[model samples]
Target: MPYMGDPTVSIILPTYNRLAYLREAAASVFVQTYDDWEMIIADDGSSEETRAYLRAIADPRVTVLWLSHTGIPSIARNKAIGRARGRYLAFLDSDDQWRPAKLAVQLDALRVSPDCRWSYTAVDLIDADGHPVDRDGLAPWVPYAGDITERLLWIHAHIAIDAVIAERRLVLEAGGFDERQRFGEDYDLYIRLAMRSPVKVVDAPLAVVRAGNGENYSANRIEAYEGWVQLYQKHSATLPGKRLRAIARSRRAENLLILARLYTNAGQSWAALRTLLLGIPGSLLTYPPWAWRAAKEVVRACFKATQRRI
Candidate 1:
């Protein structure tokens, strides 16, 4: 049955060419225990089959926006957000899914904590075939609550966008996602939002994230690291206190060093050298040991290349 009046929550789902995964994700939304919700699916020029499936959605509460392929999730999600009419906003990627009680639990948390404008839940990591993957080495699940801006800045919180439910106005106040960022856009938005309001947490894992899927955009390590560097540069100065600023600088330097190592491993010696040099100022100001580690990476690459010829 078609729902009447405005929904309490609006789900912003962005998709590319993953139709198989899209079906499962969309179905998860349809099966949610909470029914007074709408889903806005932003399709970034998917194939005809995907388009057909979207168009066949008979649910009046669902809206599909078609855009020319930008290959940018931020653009698609921002468009969907602009069209949202609900009081609260939720996010779900095309490859992820939510448990039936996801919305109910998060909504209850926000209701009890009237001061909080956002809430997030833990997530279960799954493989492409939907099999559970061990979270052994991944960031430990922490039930973070209240003002988490510093935690986000320090990269201590593992808040996943797909597991989040935030007030629509707060999301708009944060200016939505940065369109220029190809990756880590969610982290950037979360930091901005956390600065404005405290957040609640649903301790249970109610979201399922498809991990180690090579088809996902964030699977590209170089681009992901570059995105983090851009975020640090953009927000470092705005961070309050000298301690936070120093942490930002150190994190930026670490990302640059990681990128440098990646370039060295790929045999791009000149690029590696340039990246290492770029990180030097931050390393000197914050963590000087990273400078030596980056230098070693460059030297090791050169030595390996020489040994190969001999």
Candidate 2:
């Protein structure tokens, strides 16, 4: 089935004080092979320079919504979505740039897989200097198709928001982005989308994600983990079957283990021990041996420390 209508892909960009990078990002969009697109930039409390830069852009396809600094990307994103007129929607962060063929390839894939309402391409990680980082041969994503709700919830794979494009209606049906989530908001939205339909994947790397660019909205690991916990609480009840719920529990346990490690590294021994104990039951339910192994590792570390003191 051939795609119909204007074929305009609305690019939703939410930015805050990243003027230099935003210019590069917008340039990438302008150079896209698929040119029938509108770039809606939601300025979330940027400085005068940023606003002036946006105002100076002469392109008629570009639209800017100057909003008060809400400190929430989701809020900015939702505002852009409200004003979007394109049949398809794509997201690009201010600090990320796409290959010229990025939109073209994703749009082609979606056209081919008409049943798949949304799709994502693989991404290459670039350092602050914009050079590709070597990943020791690990792909950005594990390839999978069809209903990926359980797989996503279990954290077996991930879809980068910057690498994705979706039918506008489907995104709206997924409730855009959750405003309440300060971190992992994209992850929460992705889960809801996967639950609705099977997501398609474009195997090619078509986007460049700027790593460590100093505009790190997701810099707080602890708060990010807490957001994940909140997502589990929000969606676990809606998931189907005992197995899916079990996976959710295991994921929770895994996050707790991570939190405990963070605490241990920061010299909060008592808190680490308590968190580890809290995680034990769920860990045993998921993989009993892992709980035992983690306990043994903790004991060994404690024993080694005591011996050094003696």
Candidate 3:
């Protein structure tokens, strides 16, 4: 199966006020080895600079869409998915750029595994200057291959947005990304997708993820963890009652640990204690050991926070 239709891929990019990196991101898409694709970048509440920059792009395959501020990434993604008309959909973050052959390689992977409805490739961690975050090694995702669902359940979180490519119909069936979700919507969508269908790995680093200090989104870890809690709650009912309950407990425990760490980082001892108290119910002995380990880290973070001047 080479490709299903006239255009094999629809690269869906959701952006906010990230004009500084938008051009590079767009340039990466235009340079793809595979030509049968369209790039749909939906801007959610951006400044005039972004609008002008988007207009400056002359490629016929690249189109810009502007909409009001939704304050949620999922909403912006939903807007892009609505206008997409390709057999396969790939998501790219605004602040991230893909490798030159990213789309081409991933699309070929899908072609080989036509039965796989969802797939992701590896990614490199880069800094604000677009340099590698680690010179000695790649991120922990490169080794991922074969049956991913069972491995994903305990192997941490979302593999990053840039590496994902899925059949358009499968994405629609999974209800798309939950626009109502404010944080971790990417994880929400990915987990649901894994539960529904098997996932394939391209086994290549297809994108560069900008990761560094003082970042706007990554700094807000507590909020992102809270959003993860909401996601599990929202989807628990969709599966068997027993599995839902188990996952819910695990998600809650994980969330509580994050809240504790956040309070510790803020140098609020009492706040950290409260956060731990919240974790107790979810961190019961019945839950996984990872939650317990996270609980200990939170405790240390709280103490370290107290040693600092307030």
The full ranking of all candidates by lDDT, starting with the best, is 1, 2, 3
Note the residue pairs that clash in candidate 1.
none
Count of backbone clashes, every candidate in sequence:
0, 0, 0
Deviation (Å) of 117 in candidate 1: 0.6
**By summed lDDT, which 10 consecutive residues of candidate 3 come out lowest?**
149-158
Query: How do the residues 111-191 of candidate 3 rate in per-residue lDDT, one tens digit apiece?
Result: 788677878887888888888787565435545554554345454534888889988888999899887787877777776
The candidate maximizing lDDT is: 1
> How accurate locally is residue 300 in candidate 1, as Cα lDDT from 0 to 100?
74
Give the Å error, residue 28, model 3: 0.3
lDDT of 1 by residue, 1-310 (tens): 6688899999999999899999999999999999899999999999999999999999999999999999999999999999999999999999999999999999998999999999999999999999999978877877878988778877889988899999999999999999998888999999888888999988999999998888988888888988988888777788777877787888888888788777767777677788887777667768878867887877976776677678
- Summarize candidate 2's per-residue lDDT along 41-154 as a digit string, tens digits: 999989999999999988878889999998999999999999998999999999999999999988998888888998887888887778887787664477777788887887
TM-score of each candidate structure, all chains considered together: 0.95, 0.85, 0.82
Question: Candidate 1, which segments miss by more than 4 Å at Cα?
Answer: 304-310
Error of 3 at 247 (Å): 4.4
Stretches of candidate 3 off by over 4 Å are 1-6, 135-139, 145-147, 235-237, 241-248, 264-285, 288-310
| Residue pairs in candidate 3 whose N, alpha carbon or C atoms collide under 3 angstroms | none
